[model samples]
Target: MLLKSIRYSLDELIYLLNQLSDKGYSKSCESLGNETIGEHTRHIIEMFQCLENSYDLGILNYGNRERNDQIETEIEFAKQCVVEIRTGLKSENKILYLEHVIGGLAIRIQSSYYRELLYNLENCIHHQTLIKVAVLKFQNIAVIENSGIADSTSEYRN
Candidate 1:
């Protein structure tokens, strides 16, 4: 189940990456706003990579912060990250206790791999949609027709 879920996400991410690559980088008002498509792509993959690293080391990194600079799609960084994620998941570790802080309850907690993956998917999708909206708002281009978990495509050029 975990593999299937992650693979589904990987496929969605690949579609998004392809769209971003097709669009290339916008200069002023129709590409990707001030943040290039690569930037958004890298951010999403980086988030997942971090989670995978934390799971491997059994030490979760707190705070939702992005560290890398803006990237260009020529590097295909997002795809590389997805490949790494796939490799990591092949391990035998089925149960991962992800340590995270509960914001609303104001408590630290240890969550299972299933919860972690689900939450990560939700959070990443929200951020991805936000990036899509930002592009639409700044460039006046609807890169994506809709923003929903059910819609797997990303960065549709239209």
Candidate 2:
């Protein structure tokens, strides 16, 4: 159920990537506080990568992501990364610990894989919303309807 939505969200990104150029991918958007679309895309991919990379350890620390630059600088690489994320996203739900350092304090919380997956889905959509704006403003492109919108919001609007 959730995986389907996650796939759909990733597919939305793939579609957008088809229309984006390398320059557009890395171009800074004045509307988004000079942040580039690639930066946001990198963020979206890394969060999921952090989850997948640490799954075997039964612990997750999102802050420990690689912050890989290739995914953000190259549009083709970003597309490939998104496809890899879609292909790699398969796991049975299990109890996991979420470790995070907040304001010099480190903490761990018990969380399930499905819960974290849901969080990642939400995080992806949040970034997509911003990406949609940048896409529109940067290139005057028409984003797929509801691509960046929450499912509930899309339902409500209809």
Candidate 3:
């Protein structure tokens, strides 16, 4: 059930990205210090990518994100990355270690792949909210109802 929810959130993002025009996808928002929607999308996708890439290593470090620029410039490329991530997320759950560096100190915490997948799902929804704002303000496009909203929020609305 959890994995299915994560996949659904990712698919929702892909649907929203497909609706964006090239100009809309690449346009920077002055309110966001001229950061493009594509950049936000790239960041979100990279989070998932980081998890997938480090799954085999048993150590997850979010600071090691790929930050691929191609994903920021090309909608199709981002979509492909999503497909790869979805496939990676389907693997059996396993225990993993999360490494975080704070104030010059390294902290290691035990975690599971399922938990990280949930984190990525929530992270994508938050970023998609920003992307939805850009789509509305710059492109005047209406996002599919509840496309980027969390299920709890959507349920409250109904």
**Which candidate comes out best when scored by lDDT?**
2
C-alpha RMSD by candidate, in order: 6.4, 1.2, 1.6
**Runs off by more than 4 Å, candidate 1:** 22-33, 62-66, 70-75, 90-108, 131-147, 150-158
**Model 2 bad stretches (over 4 Å):** none
Alpha carbon lDDT at 1, candidate 3: 84
Summarize candidate 3's per-residue lDDT along 1-158 as a digit string, tens digits.
88888888788888888788766677788755799988999999999989988889999999989888889888999899989888777568999899999999999999999899888888988998888777777544557788779988988988
Candidate 3 off by > 4 Å = 138-142
Candidate 3 residue 80 Cα shift, in angstroms, is 1.0
| Model 3 pairs in collision | none
TM-scores of the models, in the order given: 0.60, 0.95, 0.91
Q: Against the true structure, whose TM-score is highest? A: 2
Candidate 3 local Cα displacement, residue 96, angstroms: 0.9
lDDT tens readout by residue for model 2, 21-74: 898889889978999999999999999989988788999999999998898889
lDDT by candidate, in order shown: 0.57, 0.91, 0.85
Q: Measured by C-alpha RMSD in angstroms, how accurate is candidate 1?
A: 6.4
